[model samples]
Target: MRGDVMGCSSQSTITNFSPQIAEAYAILRGIRFAMDAGLLPAEVEPDAKTIVYLIIADAPPLAEVGIVISDIIHICKHYNIWVLFTPRCANMVAHNLAKVMPAEDLFYLEEYPPYVESFVLDDKAM
Candidate 1:
């Protein structure tokens, strides 16, 4: 395993989305990305505790957020996964990036934006 970020991604919703929906969708996307990129045995550290708990409980397969939560549950069925809860303040790089990133889909495989770099370094120091 590498002691560095393998990659990161951000995507626009194309239209307005509620905070909870956006967070669930982003987590779903991140899980799919890791699966697709051959990054097995993944662990997700989410700042949203409720979402994490729902996913951990394997939320129902029906409803809106439940649909996305169900998908995450389904994926871990065949793979190793760990869901860890992290506070927003402890993940400042992610919090800051979400605030300033553009309204478009973007992916960075190791390379990060200049503005994001400092926060990342600060994170490493911790």
Candidate 2:
């Protein structure tokens, strides 16, 4: 969590899944981005404990999010990644970033967005 922000992305999808599913999708997308950028030995700290447990336990996910969990598991298998459960407060930067990002697009930030800058700074100061 102390590393520099390498990149960020947003994906807007039309689906009837719950917010948890959407979060899982976003986490998977981030992992893929990091892998593509050759950022291995990654540690993915997600605010969703269920998703983190599923990945850590290597158990089958519920039907609604099975596909996403599968993809995440596949990526983790190919890289040195650890999916840890992070509290929302500790994950404020990502939470705020998700709020301010455009829909359906992957954005690479050279700098933090204005709205999330404070959150980033707060995390850094911790």
Which number leads on TM-score?
A: 2
Q: Can you write out model 1's per-residue Cα lDDT over 1-126, one digit (the tens) per residue?
A: 323566767666675766777888888888887777777788877798888888887765466778777877888777787777788877776777677757677777766667777777777777
Cα RMSDs of all predictions?
Answer: 2.2, 2.0
How well does model 1 score by local distance difference test?
A: 0.75
Candidate 1 wrong stretches, greater than 4 Å: 1-3
Q: Model 2 shows how many backbone clashes?
A: 0
TM-score of each: 0.85, 0.86
Q: What is the lDDT of residue 82 in candidate 1?
A: 72
- Per-residue lDDT, model 1, residue 29, is 87
Q: Which ten-residue region of model 2 has the weakest summed lDDT?
A: 101-110
Give the clash count for each candidate. Answer: 0, 0
For each candidate, the alpha-carbon lDDT, in order, equals 0.75, 0.77
- Candidate 2 wrongly placed segments (more than 4 Å): 1-3, 101-104
Q: List the residue pairs that clash in candidate 1.
A: none
